[model samples]
Structures are given as C-alpha cells and as structure tokens.
Target chain A: MSAPEASVAVRQRRGSFGRLFVSELQLVFGRRRNQVGLVVLLGLVTMLGVALKVSQLRHPGARGGDIISAVAGNGIFLGFAGLTIEIALFLPLAVSVLAGDAIAGEANLGTLRYLLTSPVSRVRLLAVKACALGVGSLVGALVVALGGVLVGTALFGAGPLITLSGSRIGIGDGLLRLLLAVLYVTVGLAALGMIGLFVSTLTEQPIAATVATAMVSTLLWILDAVPQLDWLHPWLLVDRWSAFIDLLRDPIFTDRMVTGLWVDLAYGVVFFGAAWLRFRNKNITS
Target chain B: MTATRGAAGRRTLWLVAAGALAAAGITGLMARGAVADPTLPPLTPAELLAKVAAADVDGMSATFEQRSDLGLPTLPTSSLPDGEDLSSAIALLTGNHTVRVWVAAPDKAKVALVDGSTESAAIRNGNEVWLWSSEKQQAKHATLDPSAKPTPTATPMSPSEAITKFLDEIEPTTEVTTSGSGYVAGRAVYQLVLTPKDDASLVAQVRVSVDAQTFVPLGARVIADDGTDAISVAATSVDFTRPSDDVFAFAPPPGVEVTEMTKDSAPSGTEKPKGDAKEPTVHGTGWTAVAISPASTEKPDKELTTILESLPEVSGSWGHGRLLSTALVTAVVTDDGRVAIGAVTPERIYAALAER
Candidate 1:
C-alpha cells in the first residue's frame, strides 16, 4: 500500500478506538442498575447530612474531625465527610458493580463473540472497559460529594473550614482540599475497580464476579480491623481508607495518604496485569 | 529449541531466588528493629512487689515519652482554661507526647512539654506554682497552702505522674509476677507483670519496669485483653543528679498575660463544676474498681448527647443506660443519673452498682 493509504487506515483505526471508549463509558453508565446505584449513593449522602445536622442541633459543642463533626457547623466540609462515609462500602460497591459487569456481563449476554469479531484487539477491549469503569467510579464519587455539599450547605450554611488540628481555613482553600479529597477517594475506589475487573475476567457469570469482588473488598476491610493481626494491617488494600482524615489537618498530613496511594497503585498494577494476562490467553468460548 | 527453553527456565529461577532473598532481608531488618530482651536474675512475685513498694528516688530528672490509645473522643480545647497548655492531657487521652520532668522531692519539680519549636512548662517552687506557655505568651500562678502536704498533686501535669499513679494503685486482686528483664533508657530493669484476677477486667496485663539498682519504675505498659498496648510511658533518658533550684523557679516573661488562681477560684476550666455536682466516689477495689459519679444536671449539649446516644445501650440490675466499651476501658451511664467507669466489663460495673 502507498504511504497515504497506510496512514489513512491507521487514522481510521484510531478514530474507531476513540469511539469505542466513549461508547463503552456510555454503556456502563446507561444501565439501570448503575443508575440506581448512583441514586442510592446520593441518598446515603443526604441521609448522612440530615443525621449530622440533627446531632449538631442537639449538641452544639461537640468536637472532633469526624464526618459528623466536620459537617456540624461548616457545610463546606460536607464533601470530605461524605467521602469518608462512602469510601467505606458504598464507593467500593459502586465501582465493583461497573467493573464486575464489564467483561462478564458482555459474555453472559452472548455479545463477547460479536465484539471480538470486530477489528478490536482483546487488550484494547479490556483497556476500554477498564477506562469505562474508572470514569464511572469517579462520577459516583463526585455525585456523593456534590450531593453532600448541597444538602449540608442548605441545612448548616457555609462557613470557614475548621481542620482536625483546630485551625480555621478560608473557603477557597477548603474547596481545594475538598477537591483533593474527592480525587483521593476516586483513585482509592479505582483500585477496587481493578480487582473487580480481574475477577470479572475469571467468570462468565456477572453475578458471581460481582459477589466475588465485593467479598474480597470486605475481607480486606475485616483484616484491617482485626487489631491482633498487626502484620496484615500494612498489606491490606483498604488499611488506609480513613487516612483522608489527615488531609483535614492544618498542615495536611500526607504520609498515610501517600502510602495509601502507593498501595492502591500496587494493587491496580498487579490486578490489571493479571486480568490482561488471563484474557490474552483464554479461549473466548462464550 | 530445547537449549533456548532451558535458558529461559534458568532466568526465571534466578528471578525467583532474588525475590525470595529480598523478602527475607526485609523481614530480618524489621525483626532487628524490635527491642531485645536482656538477661537478668529472676525474682519471685513477692520479692518484686516488695522491691517496687520500697522503691523511692529523690532529685531525679528525666525525659519521658508517653503513648495512649484509649479511643476516646477528643475533648474540646475551648473547654480548657485560656492559654492553659493541656496538650499533655489530650496526649494522655489520645496520641503520643514527650515531656521533660525534674522532681526534687518535697514539692520542688517542673514538667516541660516539648512541642515543636516551643515548650510549655509547669514549675513548682516551694509554695508557688507557675504555668508558662511559650507559644501563647501566657502564665498562670497558684499559691499553695504552706501547711498542705507536698503531694504529687501539686504538679500533676506530666505523663510520668500517670505511670507513677498506676504503679501505686496495684491491688491485691492482681496476680503479680516477674515476666522478664529488659533494658530501658540504657538502664538494666526487671519487668514486673500483673494480671487481673477479675475475668471481667479489660486489662490483660500491666507491666512495670523497675531499675535493678534504684528500684525506681523506669517504664509502665498497660496491655488490653485484645493484646494491644493501651497506654505506655517510659523514661527515654534519666539523670539521678539533683536538678538545679533554678529549674523550679519561674517568673512571668514580659508581654505575657498572667492569671492568678486563688483558693476560691477554680484553677482550670475542667475543674469547674456545672452546678451542685459532688466529687465522684470510688467503689469496689483492685482491678474491678469503678468510679461512680453523679450525672451532670446540666446535660451535655445537643452534639454530645448524640455522640452519647450513638454508644451501645446496656440494661440489667443496674438499670439501662448507654455503654461505651473499648479494648481498655468501659464507661456506663445509668439511666437513674449515675455514671460508672473503669477497666472492668459492664456486668462488673452493674454488680458494683448493685452493691452500692
């Protein structure tokens, strides 16, 4: 083929790949279950805001940097408080639903064969699905945070952010911290998403993949809580889930936050690597 | 083809061997970081107790480090006296802190908290006690009654006081034994371990380290039933030589706010009673002791009540109220306006209340 024709063919392939990623994102978010999950997450954030407001009204003098304490009188801290609450279970569950359904759901529906018949490589398909899950996780996190800020601001009214170290910061800096908190939570959940993606590749049944992913996440949380298992604490994936609290400190403690990010990155790399290796070699019988 | 395959297999084997070596090396370094147990003569429980009871040291200065993981809610700083540095008190309740203490028996002592870049010191010189906060540029003065005994209460501000208090409160209900010997602050010490006889007590063991030479307690550790250290205080460095008299003397620096506490006035915000509240009374004895106090008439503000309500509720012969239980401590607030708290279980607290 001539140079121009070869270049044109390469450009066409690139354009199609871009379209595939966008369509994958839309398909992931377009599902009824994922939509319901997003709504449920928002509902949880609202309920938390209401509970915190009621507690604040009852005890005006309570102190701490916990979710309830942060949202008591300062609505701007709602994003941080919401992130803390959701990162425990809701965020992981949401990410798992999308990632667990990524490949397995396609196979279960008998569409995997058709998708593979296209010019797309298995690696490219997996990458697109992973990217779709990543986008979904970030959106889920932001929805919860935005819901919390709206509900908390309406009820408590906006005020200066009071850090865990008992220092007051301006609204602009508080919002910036809130953004960083949302980003941190999103990245943390994406690590869980990677695990779900790996599990999804193991089974043709979407439900089994979803359940396995959630069970693994819950097991990590349980390991983190068992005080006697001090050795397991450092290696647990969710061990530093609450380290985001350090961000609310005046100087912003980054030791645990940095450690948590590294742990998440490690998990993401290993799980994603496993998923790629498995899918690359597996016979697409489904 | 076979030769190429053999070469690939050998490379993989080498990779695994290198990885295993790295893992073992990391584990070895972690193990090496742990404190090494030292060899010493063993003593009977009775002999160790007698030595500790008879132990007394005068005119010693030391830098003490304390770490507490009580899991208690952080108390509001606004509730404390203005410019009163209660970081030590907060540290005792929650995290870790370091302070330098100098005690010259008969009420001459000083405790300086080593905060970053600045320090706060509480000095007791004869009948006058001064608290100076360098960061806040504030000072508080209190005059002690000449006839009043020079108890540790005069300067009950250091973490060492907490350790000393624990050592002094050893009860007959504890099964005392010498666990082993170890080095602390570069001094050879004997570890006298005490286990609670009461099964209801949350404390699994309390370990006290006594100096082999001076018999003074160089360190104390409170281990919860869950095998986590709830509280640990140790002297990182010690000097038996007498602290200079100037160490205990203090004068307000220029441009500092000075507050004088009189006999009729409360010294700290925490000391002030809400209204008509009597001092808490101690009940029972030993490991299962409970402090029964009258519930405050002025209820905790809305926020605090919510926090209290969030705690699990327990009902029994003692009546229903909220119960806050941690690995090391349990606090029960009875419905009938009484609060019982100790290192014992709710059932033990209920039984003690029934006796009362």
Candidate 2:
C-alpha cells in the first residue's frame, strides 16, 4: 500500500480499536490455560475459607495480628488474606500468561503478519494489547477478592469491620476499603504485565517469555528479602505490593500506598515503552 | 516503507526517552524532602533549654515514626502469639514504629501504635485509661485515683516529653550547644546538640529539635560514638488543632474481650522483681554511669542461654564474663551473677562490675 493510502486507511479504521481490544480480551479468556487458572484460584480461596472456619471451630478463640487469625473474627478479612496470598504467586502467574502471549503467541501461530497487514498500525496494536493485559490483571485480582467475599460472608456473616486502629467501622466503609485494596493490587499486577509484555517482545516463544517474566518478578521478591539490598528496595517493582494493608488502618496511612502507585506508574511506562520500541520496527516474517 | 519504518523508529525512541525520564523523576522526588533548612533567630543552648521547659501547648495531633537500629538481632515476632509481652517489647527495640497521638491539655490523651494490619492503642480520658489491641481483640480498662490531681508539669506524650527526660540528665559531664535550625513536621525548629565530655560514653551526641515559636520538641536523634543514629524519633506530620473530644473516650469494640481492673490490680512494670535480687546499684555519674543489678535466681531458658552463649567472652582484672556491645550500649554479665549495663564502653562496665 502507498504511504498516503495507508494513512487514509488507518484514519478510517480508528474507531475499530475498541473492537480490537474486545477481541483481544476474548482471545485471552478463551484459552484453556487461563480458564483453568481462574478456576483453580476460586477453588483455592474456598479451601482457605473452609480451613479457617475449621480452625476457628477447633481452637475456639484464637486472636492476633496475622491474617489467618484475623479471618476468624471477620469474614471480610478472608478477602484481604486471599488477595495477599494470591499476589505472592498465582495472580502474577496469570498476568504473565496473558502478557507473555500478547505478541509472541500471535507470531508463533503465524497470525501476527495477518493482523499487521490490516489497517491497524503497529503502535495501535500494542495499545490494544496493553489494554487487554490491564483488563486481564484486573480480572485475576477480582476473582480472588470476589471469591473471598462470597465464601467469607457465607462462612462468617459480614458486619462492622474492626480496623487496624482497634476501632470499629461500618460495613459500607470496610467494603470501600476492600475495593481500594483490590484496585491497588491490580495496579501492581498490571505493572508486572508490562514487564511481561517487554519480555514477550524479546522472543518468539510464548513459554520462554512467560517463564522469564515470572522469574524476573520472583527475583525482585527474593532481592527484597536480602538485608544488604535495602538501598534497592524502593526501586523494586514488587516491594510495595503489600502496602494495600495500609488501607485497613484507622485513618489510613497513605505514604507507602502513594509510593507504591508511583513505582507502578514508573514500571508501566518504562517497560511498555521498551516493548513498543522493540516491536514496532520488527520484521514480520513469521 | 522505509520512510514509514524510520518514522516508527523515531516515535518509539521518543517514547522510551519519555519513560526513562518518568522513572528518574519519581526516584528523585522520593529522595527529596518537602521542607528545606529553616532560618530562625539565634538562641544560646541554655536559653533554648529554658524555653523548652516553659513552653506548653493546649492541644495537638500528630503522627510520628521511631526507628531504633540497636544492632540487636530481631526475634521473630510473627510465630509468637499476640499479647506475648516480652516478644512484643523486644520487637519494638529493633524496628520502626509509627504512632498517632491526640492530646487535649492535662486531662485527656490517646496514642495509637499502628502496624500494617493491627493496632494497639492507649486512651486516657479523665481518670480512666483503656488499653486496646486489635490483633488480640482485647481491651483493658482501669480507673486512676481522681484525687491524684493533674500537676502543671504533666506533659502529653510527644517528642517533647522524651526530650525533657534526656535534658534532665544534663550535668558538668555534658556540653550543650545550638547547632542550627531545620524543619520537623514542616515546623521551623532550633536544634540543640548535647555532647558528652566522657570519651568512654557510647553516645557521641544527642540532637533535639524544638519548634521555633512554641518551643515544643518535634524530634530527637541519639547518635552513637560510631556516628550512627542509634535511636531516631521524629514527627512526620503535626497539627496543633484541638482533637475531637471523642478521641479520648474509649468503648470496647464489638467482638473484643474486655477486662476490668482496679488501679491496684492493674499490671505495672513489665518485669517482676525477683525475691532474691536486691535493688540495682548505680556507679559513677552523668554520661558514663553504669547500673549493676542482681541476676535472676531462676536459670535462663534454653533459647536465652543459647543467645547469651553466642556473645563474645571477655576477661580482665574485673573478672570473666560475656560481653554484649551495641552501638549505644555495652553490657557485661559477670560470673558472680551480676549484670552491669550502661551506654558506656566495656571498660566502664568492667569498672562498674569490679566496684564494691
């Protein structure tokens, strides 16, 4: 196609980006791996809730600051507990799967060329993929949180939330805080997705990209544990993922949470930029 | 096609540059403090000390952070059950703590020690005091003697209270000077530097910062002889506005276990005084003073014995013992069942242990 003709074609199909994003979502959710991953998450949450309930029945009155003990008192805590647990491993894995597949899966199947030949610009295609990845992370977080709420409230009725400040807050306010926690976690996972996207652009093998992305994330966590690396903790992407717990405080301490958001933004911008830089000018022989 | 490819490459490069800039900006912003060094009229150290003593405020609310890097190994608190007083107290010695304080003049106050998902609060309303712990889901209530009366010297719990205690120990062995002025919790503060004349003292200097106008202390830093901040406590944010009356009032939250106790029945000190151990004896004066106390008659627990054994053993004219030396303190456990501790060098501890 002539350059001028291609410009006209891109302008004409600009409105179809939303359709492209929807199709991308369909592709992500339609895959068997992602479907099973989500189902396993729900199953794990249910088992966790059941175990907490049983332990409470056995011990009767156990109390402490840890999440497991907190779960015995309020059902809402189950949501927090589930999210904390999944964020460590499962949710990141789910995000890595979709983001790692964003470009490489298409190329591996020899469909990237067909998609690029259409009226869509390479940059536009990446934007759509990023949006799809964002939605995928959100869904992964929501499954854990919603499942926790459903199972938790069912097992132990919801009422006033006892705050970290040892004060009582109404259920409405507690739910709002829980929602904020989910959103915060989604931001961290989306940042991880961006890293996966950058790694996805580096290779044509989807499995290799997924494994590398997951390893990069796990390595950040490991480095965070080493005392000598304290200087680098603030820069690590996974360092503040647990800052969501701050929302449960009486007046909510926003310092760490604010820093967490900034870190996520920085990672998202840089890694997404890297992915675009690598992918936009690549040969589409596959 | 080449032209389009070239344009795409340029756009991607620009995007990468923008991303890199954003990352650097965030890092720089995190490292930068909002307030710069504050300017204030000069005041001699003696005059500043007097100002701090006379200064008083009716009401205020603040969030403060305290970090004590004592070089002591942190005992794992998570595995221990909640309300294990010893573990919790030890945990406080080696980590960062954030506390929110609300005070209204002489009669009422509340302090909440907030951890990530748990809170422990002490609220004082009139003659009543309530201790609440969220993690343990427990609350303790006690009533103080109403006739005890509030003394004019009674200050609310703040950095000011702590600074006064440190200032009271000043003597000829200490040299005081005004270093400079800076900001604490966005308030202009005059810094008073206290240096110990005794070279044997582990503390090199103690810096106390007080609000320029009110003279209320906003922060304090204890610098070890090695020049490390052994204990740093500062107010991150503060407001002088009167806190709401309801803050001091405490009602046990739903689902928590509440215990009632008379003033006499309430727990006082953290450690019980052993029947065989005599009163602790103090030796020397001012900065290098050491307190020698009788060791507990009961045998040390397996864990404690192991920890004690891990310390380096020392022998001198003062006799043989295990030495525990931190940046700000040196401790000697003598074979004769005496424990001497002080913020002084091992030589001072030895002298104290050898003294009749």
Choose the strongest candidate by lDDT: 2
DockQ, each predicted model: 0.03, 0.60
Clashing pairs in 2: none
Which residue ranges in model 1 land beyond 4 Å of their true spot? A1-14, A54-65, B1-356
- Model 2 interface root-mean-square deviation: 2.2
User: Which residue pairs in candidate 1 collide?
Assistant: A58-B302, A58-B303, A59-B301, A59-B302, A59-B303
* CA shift of A281, model 1, Å: 1.0
Residue B4 displacement in candidate 1 (angstroms): 16
lDDT of 1 by residue, B148-196 (tens): 7546566554444554455556655777678778877878889888899
- lDDT against the true structure, per candidate, is 0.75, 0.83
**Second chain TM-score per prediction?**
0.72, 0.84
